[model samples]
Target: MKKTEEKIIRFIDAHKLIEKGERVLVAFSGGPDSVFALHFLKKFQKKYKIELAAVHFNHQLRGKEAETDEKFAKEFCGKLEVEFFSAKLNVKKLANSKKLSIEEAARKLRYQNLEKLCKQNSFSKIATAHNLSDNTETVLMNLLSGTSAAGLSGIPVVRGNIIRPVLCVTKQEILEYLEKNRIAFRIDSSNLSDDFKRNFLRNRILPLLRGKINPALDEAVYRTTSNLKSQLTVNERVVNHFINEFTRKKANGFEIRLNIAEVFGEIPGELLKVLIEKNFDYEFKHEDYAKINSLAKNHKGKKVNLGSGITVIREKELLCFQKEESSLTGEVEFPAGKKAKLCGVTVFIQKAEIEANPAKKKAYELISADELDEKFLLRTWKHGDIFKPLGFKGTKKVSDFLTDAKIPASEKKNRLVLLNRNKIIWVVGLRISDEVKITNKTKRVYKLWTI
Candidate 1:
């Protein structure tokens, strides 16, 4: 047996990535790394008593070049007598539609397709060709991007049903093995272009760093990431406890109610970032987390707008993720006596002649028409905005009012405030201002209902 083959088998055994009688699907991109991986897995198929198959995804970015790669993958698999599956996807279109980067769209689609094939074909494991250099690049990317501890761990050898047997190997080693065996592999031209972030790191930055700084950069990164991953496994247990105790499920997403007194000094920032990612799918930077941690010590009602349309708001006793309509805009305005759709709620505003007094309701709010002297502005609640509830003694800040009402901080941002002539008249869906209350002297009423 070859040294490379022995190393791969040992790595697989160490990770327990595959078992006897299991069917493995290879993500064959026709690239050098994947080609070597496919060959290595094929060599061990009989030794491990496992079934092998190959899958190719052509992200339609390079037109004819992508098709040629797909063709190469199919032909290569056919020559090896392995079952092959191929797919062509409009990755550019998917990226534009989802507002994701081309790289992110391609990766997500590729894994999604691979998972689908695994289930359809009853494959037990999906193997990818991520190598030691890829791990180093990923760690550098995470460090440069201000990611949490888990992000610095790089990619895992086994993530769910996906496995990477070549993670312990280097790209140079794979290339050498392929050359030694005289195995032909297609080269992706895009990898040489520095236009993409990963390519920039792979072809330029990483090589320069390795040559100038440390010759064994990949090995150092692999060891560091491995250590970090071990630390993360221990930290995850504590973080999972916090998540379970403090979080509650909502119709939109998860709500985390972290009590300032109990949570301020107890939780680590990295763990908090992981919790947010696990719950909200947002990759928060260190600065983003700095602002979040600051909220724990700062005065209540402080909020920060994180990227990816996620907002974190603070309250007296809780810190929660604010939920809003996915389609809601920054500044929203609604005309009087008209129906409009805003924030997934269809709100109708029409003048009505109510008999002297009407029953109090939860679904609608009826206010004196004279109160709406100016055009209605429907927008998110801003700090320092005050409203006087119909029966309350004095005006109160919207934030304070919501907190006092025991409203989850996450729902506070979704509470729209209707302002007239720059005065808050209604904390819509909650309370009508004292100035807008209906009385015996009220002649007309403006009714608001959500349908």
Candidate 2:
């Protein structure tokens, strides 16, 4: 075997990533790394008795460049008697629709295609040419974006069905191999563009670090990340403990009390978010943690607004967290001589005489500057959580109201009901009681909210 081929075999053999006679789908982007990877893997295929194929995803960003890459990859595979498959994806459209970055969209699309292709073709393993430089860039990018220890630990060399046989090699070594072997490959122009966060790191920050610090900065950082990953092994145990203690199941899915702000002090806030998302597939933004942390020092009963209609209730001893079932904005209305709560606003309404402003922050609704309420019903809609829908004298299942509202299944359990003396005044963001809507005979207005 050639030196490069021997190195590739040794790396994979050390990891035991590929079995003898296994079929492999190699992710070939037609770049130097992937092209050299394809060349070397083909060299070793006969000895291992492994069948090799190339899979390419055209992200449609570089227009003809993707097509050029695909054609080149196909021809290269064809010349070597290897199977080739290619797909085109609308990466930009996917990114825009999902509100994700272009890099994220392209990555997600590429992986999905790889996964689908492997499933269809019965390939047991997928190989990529991510190298040590890639690992360093990944760790740096994650750190700049406030990643946890897990993120700093760098990319895994082997992840399940995916294997990076070229991970031990550096980008410079791959280039050297391509030059020495007289190999042809296409360059992705997007890598030169600074618009992407990763490109910025790769082009600007990485070079500065290399020039200013150690010349072998990539290896240094990779080692640092490995040590950090090993060091944080103990933190995972404590994280699991907090994850279990704070989470609970309600009627719907679950809620996390998140009172462990004191228990896991040194851990980055991102880990807390990870724990929540890992357990419940739910989370708040980074700044939301700052808000929650501030509340930890304040008095109890302080409420916080979490997005997607969720609310964190900071209690004296524990935080009682739940979802708000209504729109964060918009209005609720009530009429003459009746009591109600604007279901969406979570505020109560009563008919009274003309006087004050109607819009107030907490637990109050629109009446007229004229028709105001003296008393009203206040609660969230519950499953057996009943609500008397407006214009109807009878109460319906709060679950039914949610169904009619088309509330997402994940959020169904969180809708709160506002009841006045056991009568449904409002369903909170859905419908208010008909008896309390503004009428021609309304008289007053009353308002409330703390400045």
Candidate 3:
């Protein structure tokens, strides 16, 4: 076996990234690293009896150059007698739509397409050409971007079904092997542009660091990353056990309730971080972790919203991670004598002559139509909003009233308030303004009901 092939095989064996006879899909971009990966994997395929296939994704950034790269990849795969698949993505459009950087968008799209291709073809493993230099660059990026120990550990060799076989080799080695074999590969012009952060690191920063600080920096970082991965594995097992013991599936299995006092008391923050990330597949922000630590230390009824409809509420004894219910539609216009759907409630207003029943409170409030000067507006309760309760003497802040009524904070935003000419008339589903209350002498009434 050649030296490069031996290195790759050793890494694959150590990581258990592949098994004999498993159909593997290679992400071939016709670049040096990917070309070398395809070459080495094809060479090793005969020994392991594994079926090899190649996939190419054109990011549609380099215009005609991208088409040429796709052609090169397809022709190369044809020459190797392997099945080739090609996909095109408008990366700029994707990035603009998703509000992601070009690099991030391209990566996400490539991986998504690769995963779909693997599933469609029944391939067990998806191989990528990430090399040792890639890992070092990632570690540096993570550090510069406020990362933890896990981030410092660098990218995993085996992440789910995606395997990086060339992570064991360097970019220099891949280039050397490709040159030694006289293999032709296309160069991506975008990679040479240092406008992107990764490119800036790869071209300018890393090369300078390699020349001045440490020539063997990549190997040293790789060793540290490998050690951290081992430590992380042990930590993950312990954290998962803690999570399982303290948490119960809730909300039709959409959420989990964790006994914070029992499980996380005196526990390290790192374990808690891993617990949430590993189980929920969500990364907690810095403030979120701080709030969690506060929950453990103080055991107060505090809440932290982790975005994406996910909220973490810290009760006295338990912490609940729940998917919040969608709130009512924002600000709906409610003209008098007209029924309109607002906040998932059909609000109706009509001037009616009705007898007041003393025994039963009206399902819909009967308000004197003359009292309302402008159209009723249904919207969320805002800060500094004041309204008089049906029988109250003085005005009360809507927030204080909700707090007194023990309305959970998560549901407050969905609480609808009916306003007349910017005046609070009703806290919908709760109470109506005293000014709009029907009286014994009332003849003309405006009926307001949410169905």
Best by lDDT: 1
Q: lDDT per residue, candidate 2, 1-451, as tens digits?
A: 5676677778888989888989999999999989988888898787778999998888887878778888998999899899998898999997786566787778878888999999999999999989889998988887787755677888787777999889877788889888988999989998988988899999998889889987898788878987886777777776667667766655423445545555665324655565445534243356666766666566655667654445665554554445544453222333334444333332433334543454434344443333223344344454466656776777777787776776644455556554444566555556665655655665544332111
All candidates' TM-scores? 0.73, 0.67, 0.70
RMSD values, in order shown: 6.3, 11.8, 6.4
lDDT by residue (303-367, candidate 1, tens digit) is 77775666777766666664445654454667788766656666678787875546655578888
lDDT of model 3 at position 66: 90
Model 1 spans with C-alpha error above 4 angstroms: 212-214, 258-267, 294-302, 326-409, 412-451
Q: By lDDT, highest first, what's the ranking? A: 1, 3, 2
Query: What total of clashing residue pairs does each candidate reach?
Result: 0, 27, 0
Cα lDDT tens digits for candidate 3, 1-451 = 6898888888889888889999999999999999999988888788778999999999988889999999999999999999999999889997786566788788878988998998899999999999999999999988887766788899788888999988988898889999999999999988998988888999999999889999988998999999999998897787778666666666412223444445445545565566566546355455566766665555445777664456776544456666656555588786787876765677777777775454366576767666676477888888888999888999999998987776755456668888887888889878888987777766567777889
lDDT of 3: 0.79
Global CA lDDT of candidate 2, please? 0.69
Error of 3 at 26 (Å): 1.1
Give the local distance difference test score of model 1.
Answer: 0.81
Candidate 1 vs. true structure, TM-score: 0.73
Name every residue pair that clashes in candidate 3.
Answer: none
What is the overall TM-score of model 2 with all chains considered together?
A: 0.67
Report the number of the highest-TM-score candidate. Answer: 1
State in Å the error of residue 340, model 1: 18
